[model samples]
Target: MPGPGSRPASEGPIPHLVLANVAKRFPQAASPAVDGVSLELARGEFFALLGPSGCGKTTLLRMLAGFEMPDAGSIRIDGQDMGAVPPYARPVNMMFQSYALFPHMSVADNVGFGLRQAKRPKDEIAARVAAMLDLVKLGALARRKPGQLSGGEKQRVALARALINEPKLLLLDEPLTALDRKLREETRFELVRIQRRVGITFLMVTHDQEEAMSMASRIAVMEKGRIAQIGAPAEVYERPANRFVAGFLGAINLFEARVVAATNDLLTLDSVEIGARLTVTHDRVLPLGTEVALALRPEKLSLARMPDSRWNNSLAGTVRGVAYRGEASDVEIELTCGKIVRATMANIGGARDTLDIGQPIFAGWSGEAGVVLEQ
Candidate 1:
């Protein structure tokens, strides 16, 4: 389990969900689908399992929902071991990517299906279903069948159905993928709002970086069936644990370098890629001549017609390509050493001065802008 500092501020001392040394393997696969994975989730925390396909995020989710059992280790919910619990008996509901609402059933019936199966009173189910519909903003569409609802509407209906059970945790498997891009973006905030209103822990599995970064209070980035890094979105994005994490999060320019000078608070590196010496701030004194890589995000590098004295590092390059992306323009610059570096310049004041291809440019960045990583 992670320390208290890893817990969300709203969480209590006890974790809502705990996975300890969890491992799983398929019958014919050479490697384990989930390997020695462990993490803790706080109560009411909106957490996300973020990774590409075949990274074990979905498998871990299935285990949490009791659809799949771990071959080794244990899963605990609210401090109770879930080894013997079945899917229906577990206090977890899953809203799958497909929504999976019954085509023949009315919206109200679909939302109330779980309660009806549990043999609750008709009046109680109706009342709870009505409240859930209102919560998801589908009260007006309750009488309509799933076939009549829009993609977003069907999604809300499925969400209402899942929440009507009042489960301790909700599992969302690619919850927003079915919607169009604009609608998907809109639903992200809507899902966050609904989760806050319900006040239940939401464990979502997703391959979309934007969805996880925007909606999750914390995210676990999985790679090759193991957690590469786990932290708040900003922390994981800004201070990635390794090269894989830095590259996976977004576009970054990495310069192969070696530590030439080291002090208590500063380090100097000779980078062959940039054809320049780079100075960056560091708290620890690494050994001289240690190989390392300097990582700078595209947004962190500023391009100018002339070198800026304020920059701790600067390199001369020719603009190879320029791409306009509305709010910002991505410029690809080729250094004298033939290394390519990308920089994103904001399109402030509507239309700014544009840089032409093959034009001379200087990319500069402050010492604080770069992150040092082990090769």
Candidate 2:
């Protein structure tokens, strides 16, 4: 994770967009909306700003669009400072979460509205509009009004409008929020296709972790008006910088650990909660008596009916909770030491609901399963 983090934000070739120590605050507000944040986005990269509502994800996107000015730091796009640039003057376009398309205008007209406002030639606007419609697979519905189109179709229209300007950077504010679950899933792939076709840097703000994981090549997880972590989706999800990022991306079991012994290749920690000694295969030495956190995703743990010595950590427990989720089932096991640990098992060879509530089971995990979290 640390190795992956070093590249996109700091080590890559000159970025297409750079936000350096950016901060913004509202009038008399208790805290800044965006606080001391910096990130670099590569050319033609699909980057996601992911967090809960009011976590400054939307605020960051707004800053990129020039809708709100930052009180501190600077923004640079393609080697140009944006300090004096107005919203209309910037080489960027934003597609809002609402899909702000004109209801009265036809799809083609809506897509071409920006071109008309810019006073481009009529022939060029017509040809570009037609090409964009065909790009989004909406050529047949070019004459349809926004009200007459489905949610997905309208979203395509808004996207076409944004791209018609040929922005160097494109900002998307929860672009898939309006669609149904099925459509949203379908549109995720559609978005990837469209972004690849356009070959433009995409900066998207989304609260959906799955969306970020699936669509973004990299993600910046925001917390309380600041960035908590930024890296490739898998790297961030598997090796989070702290507890907030670890728990925010997905469900995981946490244990407070105290280092009891350390060696060149591993550090052994004692956790009273599980009444077990856990080993971590660490690249660096963990000092003795140091307090740390062990984060284990549910799927990384294995539960079985019989005891096995395959894992460094294993414990006897009783099943407390069970949730059947089609492909896999989540089970909460209460260890004899009065601690609850969750495990997810794929329903492949065995019955879907094998672990009955109150049934005895064994929970186990290898040293590599846990990520030693940072404070």
Candidate 3:
């Protein structure tokens, strides 16, 4: 339902891989593990399946890797149906979270194991191994065993092994979860760079929201084994389809309202709790008296003591608490309606010095910045 107004060009080429009504279920459970999910990944695209644990993201990835079969629907790669094709037979490789490196084998042997399994000539396997190591910038560590390498190094070796086969689709399962936070952040950029350079299509499964937003060109957000939303990182974050997607992506302030008036580009909603009217932009048609929800991102709302610096929608509140973040501060305000709203303010030009807890202030946002959602 997002992007109804600023529609993108329809003539742009579609993705190379497509999933048509794919569904999966496990025995002994009433619900399906993957519940009728469908999506597409273009050639040389970086795509992410993002969700929390038990959201069916892993199950869908397993199906794509041929570890599990779908109960219905079809999966196509380059316009060819993948009907029960085994993992090895398909032109795809998966990088597991465990890395699955053999402790006894050196890095070179570990990366070359796939080639050896294919019965490639010894010289050919060696040459490919060398190239893979150099691609990952790990050629110097080729002689070391997995036991001697750090978590990040082991992950790189696993990636090199997965890429050695030059699979049409590369599936990564929580590839960076094993590393520390700082290391993971650094590796995400590296992964994106490597994928861009090779021009290979990547399908990554991860529960980290920031990871998906940063590394993927497009993301499919999953919930209860179904796709909740799919779009570019900015689109998904700014124009979520529902309350769940908005809350899951980041911090948000929500208010209950009912449509009091309607127009082509705007709708006036009467907030039940605050006893105020708010105007928002939307293309969806809702009759008057229809209930709706307003979502305001924390960063979009600002606070001030004087009502003269009027925002499009302003409400009086008292500062309940303040949490000082490194570059920004979270200000919690207790509204007159007994609802709490949070605003994030950058600590610039000594702004933090003027703020104090329990001070009465005016907190609001631009009408155009907040999004309206159907109840």
Candidate 2 lDDT over 115-153, as tens digits, reads 998999999999999999999999999989999988899
TM-score of each: 0.96, 0.96, 0.94
Q: Report the lDDT tens digits of candidate 1 across residue range 52-90.
A: 899999999999888889999899888889999999899
Q: Can you give the lDDT of residue 11 in candidate 1?
A: 51
Runs in model 1 lying further than 4 Å from the true structure: 1-5, 9-13
**How does residue 324 of candidate 3 score in lDDT?**
86
- Which of the two, 1 or 2, has more lDDT? 1
Sorted on lDDT, best first, the list reads 1, 2, 3
In each prediction, how many residue pairs overlap at the backbone (N, C-alpha, C within less than 3 A)? 0, 0, 0
lDDT of 1 at 333: 99
* Candidate 2: segments with Cα more than 4 A from true spot: 1-6, 9-14, 350-353
Better of 2 and 3 by lDDT: 2
Off by over 4 Å in 3: 1-15, 308-310, 351-354
lDDT of 2 at 250: 92
Measured over all alpha carbons after superposition, the RMSD of each candidate to the real structure, in angstroms, is: 2.1, 2.1, 2.7
